[model samples]
Target: MNPLALSIAVGDYDRTRPLASGAVRIDGVDPLMIFLTPEEIFFRAFRSQDFDVCELSLSSYCVKMANGDSPYVGMPAFLSRAFRHNGLYVRTDRIKTPQDLKGKKVGVPEYQITANVWARAMLEEDYGVKPSDIRWVRGGVSQPGRPERVAVSLPADIHIEDAPEGTTISSLLAAGEIDGFMAQKVPALGPGGHPHVGRLFADPAETAKDYFSRTGLFPIMHLLGVRRTLVDKHPWLPTALLKAFTAAKELAVGALTETGTNKATLPFIEQSLEQARALMGNDFWPYGVDANRKTLDAFLHHHHAQGLSKRRLSVDELFHPSTYETFKS
Candidate 1:
């Protein structure tokens, strides 16, 4: 039997680098790993079904799954995770707190992006701000006239308007046309920066730490998606890919723990890691369904509530059956 050929596209992160460099090989597979920006990868994957396996926006995946048009069955390989507290930016002069955002004009690159979904969920759950309370402006972060990558039918009460032609969200934000903006890749603005824009949270790292302590969720942003056709054709592919990703993650973590020379450039790598462990536990960046049920369920509820996913999806419905288990020794 010949090894299956698969094209896997993901970000060039520490966890996935091993797979691209051939240090970790997928069992019974010839993997063609392409490391690319999430924007490029996602545009191609959802728009055209470009790769055999690719990193996908969890929110978009949920929407597709709910619509019953999903081309891929998910694997539990969460390649991207972040705390979205830092992604919320507001006009410092106009919006002093979360409460100030009520009945305000807020801009978003795309309402369906995972960061915005998580940020909105956080605001509603923790600060008593609801999505329908504000009028949303939608546009590109940097470019003009960008369209939503996928179509979504939102509830009637949620108000969203497109940006004026030839303008971008950054410009609207800078001009104070929108009172605030929530996006994953918000442009830089601060004291010695664009005078009008500042983070909603002054010290985002500290705020994120506090949020984690309260909620116990380090939000997941992206997951590995295998083309459904491929999965149906190759029943063994899910387990094979999952095994390779698991090994690659272990290798990356091991490399980080080698204290003699830091794998990453930032100072206090060791201390930073210890702090994360203290907050999140030993397997801080865990993969798979059992360890991540709470986080996944929370996201599903938020997704359904926000009108992004038409129906609530359980964690068990999100991934291939093979991804939930491994062979017993």
Candidate 2:
């Protein structure tokens, strides 16, 4: 009856900080939490199954899940979530709107990354721009010669071109080689740099707000994944993970609400939170299977439609059975 020790790798987010610092602990488990960049975590996780527990790209998970090649089963912790409207960058000279992207070459660090899938969903569902509508240019965002962390076999209709030998997508977009680019991590192009390089949506916040009002989806980017071997051996592990991450998030959120001193060093924390609560309600960033079913389903449809997943993966198939429900007191 010894506490099982595990190595967990994830982002250095406020919600996950408690787990690393031991402010929150998983039931009957000892965790060695390693906060890492999403890129590094995923690159290692998919390639070598690096960590016992890790944050994973939802798109890549589905791609592997549908192919029946995944080594991990997902936990609905959803450590990372974002609108992704801001992920897009475009040249003002050529692209006027999302519609303008049709038949144009757009750059993506990886076509199957979660953010790009959500961005593509926004373009296709809201405006009628399918994934096949634009010729996709695949490359690095900041550096050169980066490839997809997990190779995906896209359908015939969807096309991708490797970025020229030594060029990064940021440079290509700046040079007008690609009409638009999905800049995952912001490239160093701002005031006094590449005058024409700008965001596709001038005010992406408002655009995202409008999108949420219509779609009810605040897109999920990453999920906690447990190695399937571990899950099969320790049947209680997934729910223990769920309980720990949920508590960590609540603690982090409580700090934001404390008016005496700010836990996060940002201006107008109170007012900003008020606006967020008004839009998405108290439990805005919710966890678990039942809560995020719509968002999950939408992502599954997008993943399948865009040819990333061979078939649409159901929410049931994505996680362990114990995680799908929790014991009620």
Candidate 3:
């Protein structure tokens, strides 16, 4: 039989680039790749189930999974992962620390996005600042009128309001209308940028590194997902996807480790690679549930606590059964 024909929608990241360029191929699959921004891929996928295989927001997926509304089953291939300590922006004159955020109005693109979830969780977990500690302002970080991708019913104590009509959080932040801003992407305060725009953490990299040392959570943002109906029809597909995506990430890792020539354009490629390995081990950006159980467990608990999920989801329920166990060599 001909290989399964499918459309794979994901970002053009180095790890996924191999699959998109055909250097990596899923077993018994013929995939048409569509590279897109995270917002685009998630908006279309969650709204319409637009692709056979897609990158899904981890928090949103858990929300759907808990509600039994998800049309997709997760794969262990985390398409995006990052330490979100650097994602929080604040006013230089005020909000010097996470605790200072209490009672302050902070802007977020969405309350349920993985980056915000991790940042908020980190703030509470490490700094003892709860989500209810701060009033939330939801709006577009850079643009105007971006709504929550997935609807959420947060606890009564958690207060959130939309940005004013025709105005972005960035503008509110620049003009000191909002005390802080939080999102994965950088906020454009204005053409030259505002003098007051700054990060809550004075040294985010050091703080993130310290957090990683304390808690081995790198914080996964996105994971690969296939439609549940398709997975039901092709039981072998989840494992096939996991294998190919792992292979693709391995190739990207190899390129990063090759110090003879810089695979990435950054100046400290070799130092950065060594530092990452030192901090998180050789398999720093690991795939598979077993390897990432701690990370997933923390995220799930935070997801439930923050009211993103209907209930706390276990790590076992996050991925399909086929992805849970692989053949032993």
Q: Please name the candidate that would achieve the greatest lDDT relative to the true structure.
A: 3
RMSD to native, candidate 1: 1.4
Write model 1 residue lDDT over 284-315, tens digit each, in one string.
Answer: 89889898999999999999999999999999
Off by over 4 Å in 2: none
The residue-level lDDT of candidate 1 at 329 comes to 79
Using TM-score as the measure, name the better of candidate 2 and candidate 3: 3
Listed in order, each prediction's TM-score against the native is: 0.97, 0.97, 0.98
How many times do residue backbones clash in model 3?
0
The regions of model 1 sitting more than 4 angstroms off are 188-192
Error of 1 at 281 (Å): 0.6
Give per-residue CA lDDT, model 3, range 66-131, as digits (tens): 998998999999989998888899987887778988999999999999999999999898898899
